[model samples]
Target chain A: MTLELSTLVAILAMAAATILTRVSGLFLIERVKLSGRARQALEAIPPAVLMAVVAPTALMTGMAETMACAVTALAALRLPLLAATAIGVVCVAVLRAIGL
Target chain B: MTEIIDETNTGQKPDAGGFMDGAKAILPLIAAVLPVGLVYGAVAAGKGLSVLEAALMSALVFAGGSQFVAMDIWTHPASWAGLGFAALLVNVRHVLLSASIGPKMTAFSTPKKYASMLFLADEIWAIAEMKAREARLTPAWFAGVVAPFYASWVLSSVVGAIGGALLGDPALVGLDFAFPAVFIVLIMNFWQGRRTGAVLLASAIAAIGVKSFTGGAWYIAAGALAGLAVAAFASQGEKTENGETVE
Candidate 1:
């Protein structure tokens, strides 16, 4: 219920920054005509970004996390998204329980 | 259904499957993000934020990764500049996401396109990309996913802020692994060929390297740049090969 002035400022600042990132791309699209190498680079963004976000967790976190990532990736090959995520959650829980 | 709607409509026909399709597609993500929202709320409460503050942040920022990072470095009095910069760095990827998907939004009016970007979180963007691959990206479809997903995040944050302590640590059940797990699945879906493999490898290496040295969120930016560099270089090589053949 209590809203600190400083906290409010910080939250607004974060929201502004996020808004800039979200809208800036549309601006870029309107200005730049992408093709060839630029198009290739754009195509790579999705996987690259997703990988970068998770790389530290998947490879650097711990044995349990790395193993769970693998399990999730393998399950994703066949299982639905929810099912694969469930398997990964269960796998990590078990691995942590065993002290991995 | 199309005929029924067409008779009542003046010119714009509701994209028949867009909204429902988006809703159905986003259901799994909604389930996955519930625990995450709860965890974020719990963490905010632990960090001394009131439930109202937590809910406000969730609703406004709506980007989970940077929100977590902000909480990590949250100060007593709060440093708006520092946290804002951190959010910018973590979310810079949205620029690339926007560029990639912006063009696919052929069905969206210019204003609608800009308005929709406000809700472009990782999950929403990912689902939108999947939808685009199959059909024209429509406003109704995007709204469908955004509505339910956004609601879950805000409501769960409130719940977590109010009752998070009773729920205890989420790591006990490994709920945190849900996000990376979901990302891994999404990555697998993005696999195109050897090119994708190269991009993923470069990204992983750079990310791990930067994370080890700097020990912060710079890894995501570094890794993304490295991957983009590789794809650009690979495309350049292809262009050269084509030139040689033309000779």
Candidate 2:
């Protein structure tokens, strides 16, 4: 595919926006002092925010995909994180191969 | 007491142990990011992006999810305005993340802040939060943790892009599974105490809710919002029981 200048620019801009989000947190967190309640809320944010992000992707894929991911997540809980991920990817491939 | 004093003094050089501590703390995070980096590489190549272009994207922008979203938009030939709008929606969460980390970074110089910001990711932020709790805010320790994480992301992206070009259909070999697999691992890492069960329940509900109401993109957003709302409510209840008001 021929590269369009516009596509290139858009991709770069998107990348910048993404980085800004990640860095903006560190930058701002240092400049401002958060109160205790704010701290508690901030602490709670990650799991909640991440669950929101990951849940839809895992479930919407389909029943088999969701189950497969659950198995992987369960395995991740028990085993080393990296190993569980490898196992999950393998499971996905094997299932897809068998027409799941 | 002397050991604690020595540790607290930034002027004293940290021995090899401190470096290793930093490395150990960041390793799992690096592992979590690797697969995503590979997927980014494969997707960019599959979309016919050049090596320099893809690598630069990872290096400069460095946001994994947004990069993937951008790539999806790239393939569709949408208007620049549409692409920008979509990108903004996806990244608005960063404003919150930045706010959480802001106060912890006061000691860093302006240049260091600007440069280090480029390496920020969800995993890195989690790791940095822990580090900040242990040490007084200093640019050196921040760099010690973030530098490796940033390098891993950029390097893996390059590797993934190259691998993507070579592998062709990533799904054939199951490389596409890498993305989700990485998240499963990360979610497990963040799952602790009651938060684990709560997150799982909320996610399951949100997933179903979003899937029924909208397709994938909106599904993700709705699901995330649902999870956040549920967590916020739960946290508020806990605070009330403890005789504190929720902020």
All candidates' lDDT scores?
0.84, 0.67
Instruction: State each candidate's clash count.
Output: 0, 14
Tens digits of per-residue lDDT, candidate 1, A1-100, equal: 9999999999999999999999999898889887778878877877887899889889888999999999999999999777898899899999999999
TM-score of each: 0.84, 0.78
The numbered model that scores best in lDDT is 1
True contacts kept of 2: 0.55
Tens digits of per-residue lDDT for model 2 on B1-247? 2223434565567544555666778888787778778888888888777767778777767677666766665654534555555565566566676675655666655566666666667676677778888775456566667778888888988898888867778876667767667666767776656744565577567656766776434544554555555555655544555434444
Two-chain complex of model 1, DockQ on C-alpha atoms against the true structure: 0.68
lDDT of 1 at A59: 88
lDDT of 1 at B160: 85
Q: lDDT tens string, model 1, B68-146? A: 8787678889899988987887788788888768888876777888999999998899889888887877677888889
Give candidate 2 misplaced runs (Cα > 4 Å): A1-3, A23-44, B1-25, B78-93, B192-216, B238-247
In model 1, where do residues sit more than 4 Å from their true spots? B1-8, B11-25, B72-77, B133-137, B237-247
> What docking tier does model 1 reach?
medium
